[model samples]
Target: MGRHRRGARREVTVADLIDALRRYPADMEVRLATQPRMPQEHSIGAIAEADGLVWIGEGRQEGYASDGVAERLGWR
Candidate 1:
């Protein structure tokens, strides 16, 4: 038997994150950092604080029920 190797993790980009939220309209937790850092597999952070939204955290998953976030992002 051969051992399985993990595939390369997908690096989520800022634009991808915006598009996902815009198109999917699903409740998702986001992570934000004050400075530039390594990218995540499926997360994004605001480049500036003025962006208005707060970053959740890494390895944190939460349910997004109401479409509030979608409406806030103008995706609704």
Candidate 2:
């Protein structure tokens, strides 16, 4: 159940909620409203609705690797 807003209850921002949820994979239907130029989603749904893999990487000088990529290309 959701807590009712009271005079003493603390307010939580959507960013805080998203940050908390980022610790786990999102598997539900979620729609977030943001600024016109802002991102609409910060996470991906575990249940894919499309074919092919979506590669998401951290913007770094060197990123992590997955052997699955090589196996998929028959290079393993």
Candidate 3:
């Protein structure tokens, strides 16, 4: 995933996510990668579509991500 470094913020929509996910297997497990400096992760606990938007809940903490995660994410 690339960062938006200019112009108005274009929020990622459910459609966008779906389109991207099409390249992967439907049964693939999804996890949240967060805190780039610390590189933490979490399981996906919930997903809901409401109020015209999709919500992805950052589930339970799965501990620090591998060292390469931060570098790959350009979060360092």
Q: Can you give the TM-score per candidate against the true fold?
A: 0.25, 0.25, 0.74
Tell me the tens digit of each residue's lDDT in model 3 across 1-76. Answer: 2337764457886677789889999999877898766888899978988889888888899888887777766676
Give the Cα-based TM-score of candidate 2 against the true structure. Answer: 0.25
Q: What stretches of model 1 exceed 4 Å from their correct place?
A: 1-6, 25-76
Each candidate's clash count: 1, 0, 0
lDDT of each: 0.43, 0.40, 0.79
For model 2, the stretches where C-alpha displacement exceeds 4 angstroms are 1-8, 28-76
CA lDDT of 71 in candidate 3? 76
After superposition on all CA atoms, what RMSD does each candidate show versus the true structure?
13.8, 18.5, 2.4
Q: Please give, for residues 1-76, the per-residue lDDT of candidate 1 as tens digits.
A: 1112464456555666677668654675454222123222334533443356544444432334235444443345
- Highest lDDT: give the candidate number: 3
Worst 10 residues of 3 by lDDT: 1-10
- List, residue by residue over 1-76, the lDDT tens digit for candidate 2: 1133553545454565668678777775443322233222233324332445333332222222235534433335
**Model 3, 11: alpha-carbon shift in Å?**
0.1
Sort order, TM-score high to low: 3, 1, 2
